[model samples]
Structure formats: structure tokens, C-alpha cells
Target: MAKIVASSPGKGILHGEHAVVYGKSAVAMSVDLRTRTTVEPINKNVVELHLPDLQTSSEWFIEDIMRIPVTSNEEIEDAVKVSEALKHLQTVLNVQVPCCTDAKQQSIYAFLFLYIEISRKYRGGNFPSVKVTVTSELPMGAGLGSSAAFAVSLSAAFLAFYGKLDKKTPLSQENLDEISRFAFQAEIIIHGKPSGIDNSICTYGGALIFQAGKIKEFLPEVPPLKILLVNTRIPRNTRDLVASVRQRFDTCPAVIQPVLDAIDAISRQSWQLLKEMSNTNSLQKFIPLLKVKFQENILHLLKESLEQAELEIFEAELGCNG
Candidate 1:
């Protein structure tokens, strides 16, 4: 088999950040940046993983790792380090696959999931000892979906390695869906509640308009939306944000329900506007509407997670009219 080298782009949602989890639609764009993974075979029974971007590496004999039990209670860090799928491959193949370790936050788990899935599917002879390298230029965790990008790149690399990238023929829609589905499965190991948007956008680049249960990549449509992202170095926990929103629903339903309803409406309208832009070629006309609806929806969601004092600060930051 030929060595596989694959790369996939980073993605960001223009609307429906957290609200999408509650079955809202969101528009997302694939940036011209990516994570890359390269796989090369060696002569031995030990595979190695190297990640130079993060300046970290770890490796274990394939046989030694297989004996390690898979435990969900052993903390996310440790469980990911010694993934269940990796152990399965090690034990079944009865070989050593040493992983070169890296600090690329998501690389290890992505590699483990893809390796095991491929091994299970082929069920052929021993997989040659290989050297795998993951490298990326995108910021690791700035909410840019770097984790999903890395996972997709690794999955694509393995698909190419096994000569399965073109197994279904001329890039049909079904083939695209299959590729994206496979990538999404690998991403689950890294992102506990992935929306699947990241994996889909990275796997099939360009502009995507995604609904609660569907995703569509629009054709050559370049909208005039001047997207701006605000990063709060405040480092809010997503779980805590969700919990706070739930608490509002439980404790102050009368006050919060209207806001949530309005936000949901905004998300729906935004999705329609994006779809319209894709069809009409009049993207400039909807730019202002897109900006207003997107900002309003996100601002309301943020309010659910903010303290009164923090809300005051946020209002001031957005200025008087905003």
C-alpha cells in the first residue's frame, strides 16, 4: 500500500454557536488552513507517531499497550492516551505499534481511533510498523474546531492509505456523506458533544449551511458577510454555560423563556438568509441582516451564562447602541 498524506481545513460557525446543540441551524465556513497527517511504513512491528508542531512525543510497544484495559472512569486524559480502539488493534494483531507522542492535544486520540478502525476493517496480515506525523498551523483550542480538523485529517490519511478514498467512484454525494460520516466517528473520541459540523466542513471544504439534522455545502457562493470573532480570554467552561442555561429554565422560566425563543427564531432566520444567499447570488443584500441576527442570538445566549455584573461589562464593551 502507498503511504498516505492528508490534510483538512479548520472551520468556524457564523451563527448558532451553542444553540445548535438544541436543534438550531447554523452557517459555517471552512478557512484556508488545516492539519496534516502523513503515514509511512517501516520494517519493524512497532509503529511510531511524531508531532513536531507541539514538541512532544510518546511511544509504546503495540503488544504492551494491548494489555491495557479500557476504562471510562480513568479520567479523559488517561483514557485518551491509551484509547480502547488502540488496545484492540494491539491485542488482535499481536504486534507492537509504538506511537510517537506530541502535544497536539487531539492527535493521539485521532490516530488511535483511525488506526484501530482500519485494522478491524481489513483484518488482513500484520500492519507494517509505521511512522505517523501530525502537524498543524491553526491555533489548538481557540474555539476554531482545531480538534475536529486534526481528527478528519487522520481519518482521511488512513482512508487514502488503505486505497479506500475512491472506493465508491466519482465523488458522488453518497461518497461524500460516507467520508464525512467516517470522519465524524473518529472525532467523537476527542469531542464529547461534537455537533458534527466541524468534521463535515473540514472533510468537504467550502461554505456549508447546516440545520439541526442536516448539512449542505453550497456551491461557489461567496457571501459578503464581514465576519468578526470575539475571543474572551476569560476561558468559560462550555459545560458550565450549558448548566447555567438549564438552571435559568428551571428557576426563572418566565424571564428566560422569551429570550431563548427569540434566539431560536434568530437562528432559523439566519439559516434561511444563508440559503437564500446561496441560491440568489445576492449575498450583499443579506449581509446586514445576517450580522444583526447572528449577534443578537449569541448575545442572548451569553446573557444566560453571565452574572449581572458581567452583563454590565459586556454591554459597555459593545457600546451604547449595541
Candidate 2:
């Protein structure tokens, strides 16, 4: 039995949060933390999943999985049809996962879906018993895109194990694109409508600008940026947050629209400044870049640009506008 292992980096959004949902541009970079997954085909009759970070393990008998309704690839390709397919898949399977939480359940669902989909095309439904093990250095739900990394690594590992992609050429643009495509499908199962920033950055492993469905690769090589991360250890649902933003826009598009526009401008300006300042690989350039930022007050302009709209809104409400 062959074993395939793959790892993908998490992402941190530098600019554009709720705004990116509105088709505005956002900037994100791959973080140091990554999610790793290993897939091993086994002679046993059960499919297994082990998540070391969560201390979780579960298995489903191949007999039970085969009983689930089969949907053709064409049907699964449609979002609505696949969503319904999962509901059926969830109902047909009674696998009780130890340490089962909402997040774990979601991840499991995504894995099962991707596995069946890819396996159907690769091995023609002559399913084999497989064990998947996953580990992650990124904190879940800390806004660092733990799920995206999971989806990316899992998709890549499965593809490699099935010989759809050459593991040696994982860095090639063609391979990255295919890996990212499967990852995005898994993301839809996890997060209702992902901005694609996390999966793109995780697959590409560099800085990027994402807008709507388009991605502009910012840096071919990962830049050496020293960043500090702090987790508040609070539980927040990404779906709820996205829903709230959508609700806000529906209620007051005029207000939220300008804010989204401002954020897009900020993201664009940031990329421009970073490109202009550090066009070369010289370490000496960074010191001058930092100096120019503070000395010229470019940071001040960005801060004021974001806040100015709120200030104007309040002033207009109170008849303080001149």
C-alpha cells in the first residue's frame, strides 16, 4: 500500500475582511503554521481518520459507506445537488466519532465528500480501506484559516495518492491550480461561501490579492516578513460573521458599500507600496522602507482614509457637516 503525505500553510489576511465578501480586493499571505495530512491505503475493510491535534479518531466500515446513495460526478458538480447529497450521506452514516465537535464533524464531512468524489474518478468505485492522519500547527477558528489548510493538504494528499498529480511537481503552477480547485470545493462544504483567499494563499504559499473570483499572485517566492500573532481564544463562527456582514449590507448598502470600497483602495495601495519599496531582494531596502512609512506618514493617510467616512457619516447625521 502506498502512503502519500502533504502539507499546506495557513493564511493571515492583512487587509479587507468583511469587505472582500462584496467583491472587493483583499490581501493575504501564507503563515508559518501549516496543516499536514497523510493518506495510506490499507488492506482492512474500514476507512479511518485520525486527528492528532484534536486527539480524535473515527472509522466507518466500508460496508456502511457503500450503502450511501451514489451521485454521478455531474450531479455532484452542481452546488445545490451536492449540498443535498451531503444531507443524505449524513443520514445514511451512523459513525459516532470520539471527540466529535461541530468543527470535527464539518471537517469529516468535507473529507468524506472529497474522498468519494476523487476516488470515483480515479479507481472507479472499487474503494479500498484507507486511513487518514492529520496534524496542524495552526489554531482553529483564530481567523488564521485552519480549515482552508486542512482542505488543501487533504485534497493534495488524496490526489497524490491516486496518482492524479505528481508529488514531485507539487510546486508547479498547473499542480497548484488543480490542488486549489479541489480545496475550494471542500471549503464550500466547510464555509458556505469562502472568499477563496485562504485556499489560494495556502496552495500558492505566498502573498496575493484576491477579488471576486480572480487572484493576482503578489510574490512568486514567499517574502521574509517578521510578524507576531496573538490569539484571543474566543469562539466565533465564520458563517455567522459572514451572515452578519451580508445582513448589514442588505440593510444599509450605502454605508457598508463605501466602507468596502475604501478597504479595496487600501488593499490596492498596500500592494503598490510594498512592490515599489522592496522591488529588489536587498535586506538594506527594508530599513529605508520602514523609515519612509513613518517619516512620510503614509500610515497616517491610510488610517484617516478608513475613519474619515465614519466621521463624515456622523457629522452629517448631526448637521455638523459644513
Candidate 3:
């Protein structure tokens, strides 16, 4: 009917960033930064997209998107799989892959998938006309959950537009969960099978423990800590980042698997420490917490070093600033 706007928080992975992709538990906390999306009906019979951060804009006739095809999860074809759907949409949209980075392509693909599939499911295949615009306070591709926040906000906005979400009760658990669910689906297209922690943090605006595609919410026990979020401004595709970690693990499972287990242990222990710190002034558990933090810190340093090796190869391929 009228214009709808929704926003979702960005997140910081306190522990288990790379390990989480391997189905290890991670702790994700919502950050101050967020992404906002607006969806409004248009009479032009076209679906328009505006991604200001990406400096990109496009529009598609509803007729064209509908003709691209739709199917249920159980009945999906190779092209319908979330991983392949973007390429399929790309061929249909006639968007040149050479002109866009993998990050940019995936961002556009996630949006288009959500718009087309969510609209089809919620508003029926009648091809509703709408314009969707996205604006973000988070730095793009800096690994601050910017993509997850974007997806969550886009999902919320589209759901609200199609009468699947309540504008007045956007904060309701039901609405938040629905937004998170759809955002995770979009995450699959972008991250190639995310752990669902980022979208959960963005949707619920709190701390979460996510593993094996299931997320558990934890109370915000401790006060917010002051920390700086550095945006290196180095353009890197998240999928590439994840793939690097996967490649390392795949190559050295004997050595790397234990490291991932250690990381998971660190996350679980830190989560417990947060809960303990929230309660009594007991210093007994504090030492263990410090130890866990120290261990995780070491792991993080190792991860960066490993990633640097991979990045050097990319630098040689794409120049310092591709």
C-alpha cells in the first residue's frame, strides 16, 4: 500500500569468525551501525532497486522476474538452488559480471532473490510494482555484518510491504523472527551457507550463540564495552574470505580441525564468562575468562596471518586496490 521502512542492526563476531563457517559456535553481538531499507508500491509495473552504498541502481519489469521461474525448496532445480540462483538471475537481468565485483554481484543477487521470491510467496505471482532502496551506516565489505544487516532490513521492508509484517509491531518477536528467517535465506546466497549468527544478532538486537544453523539468544548481561571498529577500506569479497578459511581447513584438516575446536571452546567459555560477569562480583571465574580471551586472541591473530598469505596472492592478481 504505502511506503514501508525497516532497519536491522549490524554485528560483531566476538569469537569464532572463521570457525563458525565450519559449523562451530559463534557469539555475535549487535552493533550500533545498521542498514535501512524502504519499499514502496509503484504504478509502473516494474521493480526498481537502489543501492546507494554500492552506487548501483536497476529496475526490472515484474513480467520478466516472474518468467525467471519459482519453485519450492524440495523441488528446486540446479538453477533454483540458492547458490546458483544468482547466476541464473544474472543471465536474465543481462548484468555483465565483468563490471561488478563478486561482493557487488552477490549483494544485488540477494536483493533480487528476496524481492522476487518473497513477493511471489507473500503477494502471489501477480507481479506487484515496488521500488526498493537500501542505505547503510556500516562500512561495506569490512566484515562488520554489513551484508547481513542489509539482508535483514531488506527482508523486513519487503515483508512489511507484502502485509507479512506489522509496521506497528515491528519489534514483536514474531515479526523479528520472520525477518531473521528470510534474511538467513538471503545470507545463503551471499555467504554460501552462513551460520545464521549475523542475521540473528541484527534481527534480535542482542547477543546470540549460533551453531549448525541454529541460534540461541542470550540476555544482554554485561554493559556495552567501548571498542573501535576499524574499517580497513580494503575491498574483499566475504565469500572469498570464507573460502580462504575453508581452503586452509580443507588442506590441513589434521592441523586445522583442532584449531577450530579450540576456537569453539574459547567462544563457549567466553559466553559463560559473560554470564558470570553479569552476575555476582565473583573473581573466581574471571581468571578463566581471561585465559579464554587470551587463547581466542591468539587464534584471531593466527587467522589474520593466514588470511594475509591468501590476500597477498589476491593483491598480485587484482593489484593493491581492485
Best by lDDT: 3
The sequence of per-residue lDDT tens digits that candidate 2 reaches over residues 226-270 is 667779999876766777567656655676676677678777766
From the highest TM-score down, the ranking of the candidates is 3, 2, 1
- Give the poorly placed runs of model 3, Cα more than 4 Å off: 73-80, 87-91, 95-100, 167-170, 220-222, 280-295, 299-322
For candidate 2, the TM-score is 0.83
Give the whole-model CA lDDT for all candidates, comma-separated: 0.64, 0.75, 0.76
> How many backbone clashes does every candidate have?
7, 0, 0
Stretches of candidate 1 above 4 Å error? 64-106, 123-125, 167-170, 216-220, 229-260, 280-282, 303-322
Task: Give me the runs in candidate 2 sitting further than 4 Å from their true place.
Answer: 72-78, 94-101, 281-322
1-322: candidate 3 lDDT, tens digit per residue: 8899888878888788878878887877788887999988888989999998888898888778887766466356423466565666767777753223466677878898888777777767667788889999998788899989999999988888777775464367898888887788788777765777888888887677788767754765443455467788888777777776778766557656666787788778777776666566765657655566856667555376566555656776788566
Query: Can you give the lDDT of residue 194 in candidate 1?
Result: 58
Predicted candidate 3: what Cα RMSD to the true structure? Answer: 5.8
Q: Tell me the TM-score of each prediction against the true structure.
A: 0.73, 0.83, 0.84
Which of the two, 1 or 2, has more TM-score? 2
Expressed as tens digits, the lDDT of each residue in 1-322 for candidate 1 is: 6688888888877666655655656667887678899988777667688878768675656665444444333234433534555556456545444332222434565566567555545534335467888888777656677767777787777767777677553446665665676576665555545567777778777777665646744534545556666666664433344555556556555555466556657766776787687677666778788779867866776465435435655677789667
Evaluated against the true structure, the overall lDDT of model 3 is: 0.76
